[model samples]
Target: MREAAEPRRVARVILLDPEDRILLLHGHEPDDPTTTWWFTPGGGLEGEESREEAALRELAEETGITEVELGPVLWRRYCSFPFAGRRWDQDEWYYLARTTQTATAPAGLTELEQRSVAGLRWWTSAELSAARETVYPDRLAELLQRLLDEGPPSVPLVLAPEIV
Candidate 1:
């Protein structure tokens, strides 16, 4: 069971490759709540901006991944909870970003400066799978496997997470 959403905003990306890596950022968990061991590079969507634009802006600002093809909405979760006695609502949206060049981002980003994320490394699917306990785990991995068996397709993915 899940609780109702709180009042907050957030946007994110799921940059992937034919090989198993997806762009990710490492960060220290909040001390008080102890949440967020690590998180992808993203921020809140400004008013009147569409989700796609917000996502693109966030990736560019955080990971220097501007000018890439942003795909359809791949995953969306409206979650809220209390941690360290503070209520928070996180409406996160994930997208598939395809690019020919690698990405660049700041390093040594701290929780403050909020934009302090400075990670510029590629993480393999195996790494993501291994960190499922902390980071997001979605069917995109299975989709990657499928694409491996059959070369990348020219279709849009209306995906929902796989459950066992």
Candidate 2:
């Protein structure tokens, strides 16, 4: 009998800017619970592809930013949980990226439900305090606060730029 393959590692960028704004995306898929809510922009790493390449692809796909700057990842982690008697697999990767020039709305997305997420808004640290409930109840808010207080982190903030 053949053994099942192990889940590969993946990395994503939880992009932020000097303005204290973190890029949040709202994917409007019915099957996706966080569709309506805001979460940092990022996705999975492809086979044998560099983390930097995957980060660029995922960021472009989700946020429609063709231009980005990739900085050293701010966070790295491995998370696993099961649902409905099946293993839910995800190796989340988070990088802290920022854009050099102003950003434009995503031109078009392949996903159907994610289309309605045109409501891109920038939230400051203070604003996050008020809208804390809108995000996942994890260390995200706390991390943001720490980043804000300390300013340009001693660690590199993942920075990415859009290129055609």
**Highest TM-score: which candidate?**
2
In the predicted model 1, the residue pairs found to clash are 20-125, 106-118, 107-118, 109-116
Give the TM-score (vs. native) of candidate 1: 0.65
Candidate 2 residue-wise lDDT, 24-138, digit = tens: 6653434545535666665557687887888887777766776666766665545454423445355555666777534746554445435446455566767776774555324
Residue lDDT tens for model 1, 1-164: 89865555666777765564777765432443233444566667789897788888877767666657877655566555454446656667766677665747553233452433323467775664555545443544565556546644565444443221
Task: Output the lDDT of residue 156, model 2.
Answer: 47
Using all chains and alpha carbons, the TM-scores for the candidates as numbered come to 0.65, 0.69
Query: Cα RMSD to native, each candidate?
Result: 5.4, 7.0
lDDT, model 2: 0.60
**Worst lDDT window (10 residues) for model 1?**
108-117
